[model samples]
Target: MPVREFSSSVPLWAKRIASAIYVERRRAGLTQAALASRAGVRQATVSQAENDPRSMRLDTLEKILASLDLTLASARRPH
Candidate 1:
Protein backbone atom coordinates (compact mmCIF):
# COMPACT_ATOMS: atom_id res chain seq x y z
CA MET A 1 0.00 0.00 0.00
CA PRO A 2 1.13 3.54 -0.63
CA VAL A 3 2.19 5.46 2.45
CA ARG A 4 0.73 8.84 3.21
CA GLU A 5 1.16 11.36 6.01
CA PHE A 6 -1.88 12.50 7.92
CA SER A 7 -2.93 15.93 6.77
CA SER A 8 -3.11 18.62 9.43
CA SER A 9 -6.10 19.93 7.52
CA VAL A 10 -8.03 16.84 8.51
CA PRO A 11 -10.73 17.17 11.14
CA LEU A 12 -9.82 17.26 14.83
CA TRP A 13 -11.53 13.99 15.64
CA ALA A 14 -9.18 12.11 13.37
CA LYS A 15 -6.13 13.62 14.96
CA ARG A 16 -7.62 13.34 18.43
CA ILE A 17 -8.26 9.66 18.13
CA ALA A 18 -4.77 9.03 16.82
CA SER A 19 -3.25 11.11 19.56
CA ALA A 20 -5.39 9.40 22.16
CA ILE A 21 -4.02 6.02 21.22
CA TYR A 22 -0.49 7.25 21.58
CA VAL A 23 -1.26 8.99 24.84
CA GLU A 24 -3.08 6.08 26.33
CA ARG A 25 -0.37 3.65 25.37
CA ARG A 26 2.12 5.75 27.23
CA ARG A 27 -0.19 6.23 30.20
CA ALA A 28 -0.71 2.49 30.40
CA GLY A 29 3.04 2.02 30.29
CA LEU A 30 2.83 -0.39 27.41
CA THR A 31 5.31 -0.25 24.61
CA GLN A 32 4.05 -0.74 21.08
CA ALA A 33 5.76 -4.11 21.18
CA ALA A 34 3.97 -5.08 24.37
CA LEU A 35 0.60 -4.01 23.08
CA ALA A 36 1.14 -5.91 19.86
CA SER A 37 2.20 -8.97 21.78
CA ARG A 38 -0.90 -8.83 23.94
CA ALA A 39 -3.12 -8.20 20.94
CA GLY A 40 -1.59 -11.07 18.98
CA VAL A 41 -0.52 -8.89 16.07
CA ARG A 42 2.92 -8.03 14.78
CA GLN A 43 4.93 -5.13 16.22
CA ALA A 44 5.06 -3.68 12.70
CA THR A 45 1.28 -3.57 12.67
CA VAL A 46 1.36 -1.44 15.81
CA SER A 47 3.89 0.85 14.17
CA GLN A 48 1.71 1.07 11.10
CA ALA A 49 -1.22 2.16 13.22
CA GLU A 50 0.87 4.95 14.65
CA ASN A 51 2.83 6.13 11.61
CA ASP A 52 2.11 4.37 8.36
CA PRO A 53 -0.57 4.19 5.70
CA ARG A 54 -4.17 3.58 6.59
CA SER A 55 -4.41 0.30 4.70
CA MET A 56 -4.69 -2.26 7.42
CA ARG A 57 -7.70 -4.58 7.54
CA LEU A 58 -10.64 -3.16 9.45
CA ASP A 59 -10.73 -6.21 11.65
CA THR A 60 -7.08 -5.82 12.46
CA LEU A 61 -7.51 -2.15 13.20
CA GLU A 62 -10.43 -2.96 15.42
CA LYS A 63 -8.34 -5.54 17.24
CA ILE A 64 -5.60 -3.03 17.89
CA LEU A 65 -7.98 -0.30 18.95
CA ALA A 66 -9.92 -2.66 21.14
CA SER A 67 -6.69 -3.69 22.77
CA LEU A 68 -6.24 -0.06 23.72
CA ASP A 69 -9.85 0.14 25.00
CA LEU A 70 -11.04 2.15 22.06
CA THR A 71 -13.97 1.26 19.82
CA LEU A 72 -14.90 2.38 16.35
CA ALA A 73 -18.27 4.07 16.15
CA SER A 74 -20.44 5.16 13.27
CA ALA A 75 -21.29 8.83 12.99
CA ARG A 76 -23.39 11.09 10.80
CA ARG A 77 -21.70 14.10 9.31
CA PRO A 78 -23.04 17.51 10.25
CA HIS A 79 -25.42 18.87 7.69
Candidate 2:
Protein backbone atom coordinates (compact mmCIF):
# COMPACT_ATOMS: atom_id res chain seq x y z
CA MET A 1 0.00 0.00 0.00
CA PRO A 2 1.13 3.49 -0.77
CA VAL A 3 1.66 5.94 2.06
CA ARG A 4 -0.78 8.77 2.07
CA GLU A 5 -0.13 12.30 3.10
CA PHE A 6 -2.62 14.40 4.98
CA SER A 7 -3.51 17.94 4.00
CA SER A 8 -1.18 20.60 5.38
CA SER A 9 -3.97 23.04 5.92
CA VAL A 10 -4.94 24.23 9.37
CA PRO A 11 -7.54 26.95 8.58
CA LEU A 12 -9.96 27.54 11.46
CA TRP A 13 -8.26 24.90 13.55
CA ALA A 14 -5.34 27.18 14.24
CA LYS A 15 -7.68 30.02 15.17
CA ARG A 16 -9.67 27.76 17.42
CA ILE A 17 -6.58 26.35 19.05
CA ALA A 18 -5.17 29.80 19.48
CA SER A 19 -8.43 31.04 20.95
CA ALA A 20 -8.59 28.16 23.38
CA ILE A 21 -5.01 28.68 24.50
CA TYR A 22 -5.52 32.38 24.88
CA VAL A 23 -8.71 31.85 26.83
CA GLU A 24 -7.20 29.21 29.08
CA ARG A 25 -4.15 31.31 29.71
CA ARG A 26 -6.34 34.24 30.62
CA ARG A 27 -8.57 32.13 32.81
CA ALA A 28 -5.47 30.95 34.61
CA GLY A 29 -4.51 34.60 35.01
CA LEU A 30 -1.27 34.11 33.13
CA THR A 31 0.50 36.44 30.76
CA GLN A 32 2.15 35.13 27.58
CA ALA A 33 5.45 35.32 29.43
CA ALA A 34 4.22 33.18 32.27
CA LEU A 35 2.68 30.68 29.92
CA ALA A 36 5.92 30.46 27.99
CA SER A 37 7.79 29.85 31.21
CA ARG A 38 5.47 27.05 32.21
CA ALA A 39 5.72 25.50 28.77
CA GLY A 40 9.51 25.93 28.67
CA VAL A 41 9.29 27.68 25.32
CA ARG A 42 10.02 31.14 24.06
CA GLN A 43 7.22 33.70 24.19
CA ALA A 44 7.55 34.22 20.45
CA THR A 45 7.15 30.49 19.88
CA VAL A 46 3.89 30.54 21.79
CA SER A 47 2.75 33.58 19.85
CA GLN A 48 3.55 31.93 16.54
CA ALA A 49 1.88 28.68 17.48
CA GLU A 50 -1.21 30.54 18.63
CA ASN A 51 -1.09 32.84 15.64
CA ASP A 52 -0.32 30.16 13.03
CA PRO A 53 -0.54 26.63 14.22
CA ARG A 54 -0.25 25.36 10.65
CA SER A 55 3.41 26.27 10.63
CA MET A 56 4.09 24.39 13.84
CA ARG A 57 5.32 20.86 14.34
CA LEU A 58 2.89 18.31 15.81
CA ASP A 59 5.22 17.69 18.73
CA THR A 60 5.47 21.39 19.55
CA LEU A 61 1.72 21.80 19.22
CA GLU A 62 1.22 18.83 21.46
CA LYS A 63 3.51 20.32 24.08
CA ILE A 64 1.72 23.65 24.00
CA LEU A 65 -1.67 21.99 24.23
CA ALA A 66 -0.41 19.81 27.04
CA SER A 67 0.82 22.86 28.87
CA LEU A 68 -2.68 24.28 28.58
CA ASP A 69 -4.10 21.04 29.98
CA LEU A 70 -5.58 20.04 26.62
CA THR A 71 -5.15 17.20 24.16
CA LEU A 72 -4.97 16.73 20.39
CA ALA A 73 -7.95 14.40 20.58
CA SER A 74 -10.00 17.37 21.79
CA ALA A 75 -8.67 19.47 18.93
CA ARG A 76 -9.70 16.99 16.25
CA ARG A 77 -12.90 15.11 15.50
CA PRO A 78 -14.60 12.89 12.98
CA HIS A 79 -16.13 14.60 10.02
* Candidate lDDT (C-alpha), each: 0.65, 0.70
Model 2, 66: alpha-carbon shift in Å? 0.8
Model 1 residue 72 CA deviation (Å) reads 1.7
How does model 2 score by TM-score?
A: 0.75
Q: Summarize candidate 1's per-residue lDDT along 1-79 as a digit string, tens digits.
A: 1233467665555544455556566768999999898778998887776653256687887777788877655211110
Candidate 1 residue 46 C-alpha distance from true site, Å: 0.4
| Residues forming the 10-long window of minimal summed lDDT in candidate 2 | 1-10
TM-scores for all predictions: 0.68, 0.75
Q: For model 2, what is the C-alpha lDDT against the true structure?
A: 0.70
Model 2 segments beyond 4 Å from truth?
1-10, 76-79
For residues 1-79, could you state the per-residue lDDT of candidate 2 as single tens digits? 1222334565666666766666667778888888888888889878876566777888887887788887877654321
lDDT score for candidate 1 against the true structure = 0.65
- Could you tell me the lDDT of residue 33 within candidate 1? 95
